[model samples]
Target chain A: MFLAVTGFAILRLHSLFAVVMLSGVYSLIAAAMFVALDAVDVAFTEAAVGAGISTVLMVGALSLTKQREKIPVHTPLLPMVVVLVTGAALIYGTFDMPNFGDPDAPANRYLVDRYIQESPKEIGIPNIVTSVLASYRGFDTLGEVTVIFTAGVAVLMLIGGARRRRRPDSRAGPEATRE
Target chain B: MTFVLAHLNYWVVVVLMMIGLYIVVSRGNLIKKIVGLNIFQTSVFLLYISLAKVAGGTAPIADERFTVYANPLPHVLILTAIVVGVATTSLGLALVVRIREAYGTIEEDEIDLQDDEE
Candidate 1:
């Protein structure tokens, strides 16, 4: 119910500011849903990243652009049709997926058992999620961190570098004056 | 009826995904499109977490008493994905900021029109 309402609100709203606020609300609701699904770590990260960091970054971006969306000129029919067809195909695909919480599901059959049985001894961590994320998948986690680092660099280059070179003469400078 | 109820979460996920896709496709505002992309990514996150669940099992914590643990692999994978999502979103937004500075408008049609004139 919350998800439906939030998704609809995001669709209906045109004010970019209000939409960003609603997206934060959506993320919080999603974090709560994650908690219900027994993914505490995921919930924590979602709350921090989705609700916190992204909202802040979005507001920062919003400050640099128009606050309201201009009315769309083109008809939305084509996009609606495309979305409907794609959604229908995804629903059809889901029919073959194993039922919720089926222990014998293919995803749970092989490596999961070993992780459950031996992670405690192998990694000496009580939380198997952390153990798997940090130890068993250390290389993957490193790559993820690298991705984040690269993103930071990219954002800095895109937003920061431009401001620096755009105005070299002013004493007050562009950054301090813009804000 | 049983089949529908059994996969209710998936259906909800699908609904959310379509909504996101619609926003991305129809909205002219770049920031709104990014918001939609976030919603779409989130629905995928829910799908993965839902699949990782095991009936009557606790979180994947190693302990003597609890034998059944939800699959930890999906949780691990989604954690990485969520981080990646944030990175992509921020980068996209930064690009939007730059677009506004260069073109003097964030609306897609307006930017295209400005480009045509130049």
Candidate 2:
């Protein structure tokens, strides 16, 4: 439901506001699902990154401009059909997903369990998620930080830099010329 | 009430999350986008807090009394996440202010049109 609604919003909404909100909706749903799966840490990170900070920045961009201008809209039928087919395929794939909280599930039996059981002695962190995110995947986290930093720098250098001055008042310029 | 409250955190998170997402996607105003972002970030806080609960455990302070304790790990993780969230928001807002100054408009289409003219 979250993905479907948000997908529609991203597709159909002309204004940036609706699109950002729909994206937030998508993140929120994912957070809930994370909790249901007993992955609280992932849920927390997603909620913060997906819902909170991103939305605020996007909306801030919405200010200082004319609210959406109306335009002749296209139906976008082909994209919708493609999305529907993709969604159906994804749902079909989920049939092979382990039941909710299955102890014997491959996911449970392998990676997460190994981390939970072995990390205590290895990395010495009580929280498996933290250990996984910080230690084993430390390089990935660093890369993510670098990406964000680069994005910030790129936006600043590109869109956030100096403004072009507007033309001087025509009347004032003409009066000065006449004088 | 407590039981419902515990379970309903998910729903609350969902609603707030959507509201934020809608603002970010549908709105052209950059400030509105940031506000939506904040709302979305808050939803994650709710999810973490819900999972951190130990049902019958007290606050995580290790004292002589209140033996049962809610998990401390989630709280610690959330604190870091909160810092990161703040950092991102400030950066994003800074970007928006700059965008407005440069483009002279916050509307995405307007900016694009202005760029095309340039």
- Top candidate on DockQ is 1
Per-residue lDDT, model 2, residue B13, is 52
- Each model's lDDT comes to 0.91, 0.56
Task: Name model 1 segments beyond 4 Å from true.
Answer: A167-179
Candidate 2 lDDT over residue span B1-118, tens digit each:
6444434545555555555565555555565556567666766665565555554554443334554444444554565565566567667766665665566565566778898998
TM values, all candidates: 0.96, 0.54
RMSD of model 1 against the true structure: 2.1
Tens digits of lDDT, candidate 1, B1-118 = 9788768889999999999999999999999999999999999999999999888888888889999888899999999999999999999999998887777788898988998999
Q: Which ten residues in a row have the lowest lDDT in candidate 2 chain B?
A: B55-64
Clashes of 2: 57
Which parts of model 2 have CA positions greater than 4 angstroms off? Answer: A2-19, A69-72, A95-100, A162-179, B1-118
lDDT of 2 by residue, A1-179 (tens): 45445544554566656666766776677677556544466567677766676666555545433345344244445544554564455445444544332345443344543554466578775565566567877775676677567667865664434333323432222213444
